[model samples]
Every structure is written in structure tokens, then in C-alpha cells.
Target: MRQPPSRTAVLKVTAYGLWGGAVCSAVVSLLVSLRFQSLAPGLDQKLFLVGGGMALLYAIGGCLAYPGLVFKPKEGQPG
Candidate 1:
């Protein structure tokens, strides 16, 4: 059986995931806001929706276990 993650390790992973997601979200938000004045209202809404959706997805990935080592499987491996 695998040993459980230590508190410090869990915190580190959580921090990294949140920090990375925040930075990525900020960059995407900035780019979207910059182009907001140029994009048609419909396009602007679509962009915002997609960007927010991606950010949420990233956040979810953050809470998930590690790649290969955890429950996550390696790429190309059968589920």
C-alpha cells in the first residue's frame, strides 16, 4: 500500500496548483479585457465564458492526485 501524503507535501501541491492557475487566469483575463473593446459583444462573451471554463478546469486539476504516482494515469496508458 502507498503511504499517504504528508501535510507539507499536500500544502505544496495545493499552493503550486493555485498559484499557477491564478497566474494563468490573470494572463488570460488581461488579454481578454484588452481586446474587449475590439471584439463584438457576442465574441467577447464567448471569450469570457471559455476562459473562465478553462480556469475552472485547471483548478479542478490542481485538487486531483499526481500524475503516474497518484491515481492519475500516464499518457497513452489504458484506463
Candidate 2:
């Protein structure tokens, strides 16, 4: 059986996961935005900023919320 990871280890893993997710999200967003730019004549700067800000907030919330799910304790182990 695998030993439970330390809190610090769990946090480190969470941080790395969050960073990887954010990078992936940003890259996808960039590609979509570029595609939009090609399809549309002009993009609204404020609209783009608001959308990006909302997405960043969502990502931060998910990073804060998901560690509990990822680091679940094994059966018979204290959480």
C-alpha cells in the first residue's frame, strides 16, 4: 500500500497541477482568440479583458477548490 503524502508534498503537487492547468488554459484561450480575430473584423478590448479576467478568476477558484478531491485519503486512513 502507498503511504499518505505529507501536507507539504500535497500542496507542492497542487501548485504544479495548477500551473500546468493555467498554462494549458492560456494557450487554448490564445489560440481561440487568434481564431476569433481572423473570423471577426475587430475585437473589443474591454470585452476581451473582462472575459480573460473571469477565466482567471475561475481558474484560481478551481485551484483552491480541487486539492481536496485530488489528495483523498486512502481507505482506513484519517483525512
Candidate 3:
């Protein structure tokens, strides 16, 4: 039988996935905001802001889920 994945491994994958989503959202927002010059005066701004908020939320969730990715373990501590 195959062994189940460890908690840390699962968390690491989740964190990476969230971060990747954040990047994709930000990029798409930027492109949309820049490419659609005919959009209403403030609609583009709203879209950009909403996208930024989503990116921030994703990044925050990723950080919370896998803090080890952002902070190094102290010396002698098992990472």
C-alpha cells in the first residue's frame, strides 16, 4: 500500500497553489486594466482594486497556512 502524504507536504502544496493563484489574478487584473481603455471612467479602477484585494487575500492565506516558507527555523530546530 502507498503511504499517505505528510501534513507538511500537503500544506506546502496548498501554499504554493495559493501563491500561484495570487500571481495569476494580479497579472490578469493588470492586463485587463491596461488593455480596456474604453471601459467606464472608474470601472477599470474598481476591477484593479478588487483584483489586488483578491491577491492579497490569497497571499495572506498562503502565509498563514505555511509560515515556514516565510520564516526560517531557529538554529538547531527541525524545520
TM-score of each: 0.48, 0.49, 0.77
How good is model 2 by TM-score?
A: 0.49
- Candidate 3 C-alpha lDDT tens digits along 8-76: 666777888888888888988877877774678888888888888898888887886674767533444
Q: Put down candidate 2 lDDT per residue, 1-79, tens digits, no spaces.
A: 9978866556557666766666666666666666677555555343455456656765675566454555544454332
lDDT top scorer? 3
Candidate order, TM-score descending: 3, 2, 1
Alpha-carbon runs more than 4 Å astray in model 2: 38-79
Q: How good is model 3 by TM-score?
A: 0.77
Pairs that clash in candidate 3: none
Candidate number that wins on TM-score, 2 or 3? 3
> Candidate 1 on 1-79: residue-level lDDT in tens?
9777765466557757865885698579658956894767567667766777777666666655444333544444322
Q: How well does candidate 1 match the true structure in TM-score terms?
A: 0.48
Worst 10 residues of 1 by lDDT: 70-79
Backbone clash total, candidate 1? 0
Name the Cα RMSD for model 2. 6.2
Candidate 3 lDDT (Cα, whole model)?
A: 0.76
Please list all clashing residue pairs in model 2, or write none if there are none. Answer: none
Each model's number of backbone clashes?
0, 0, 0
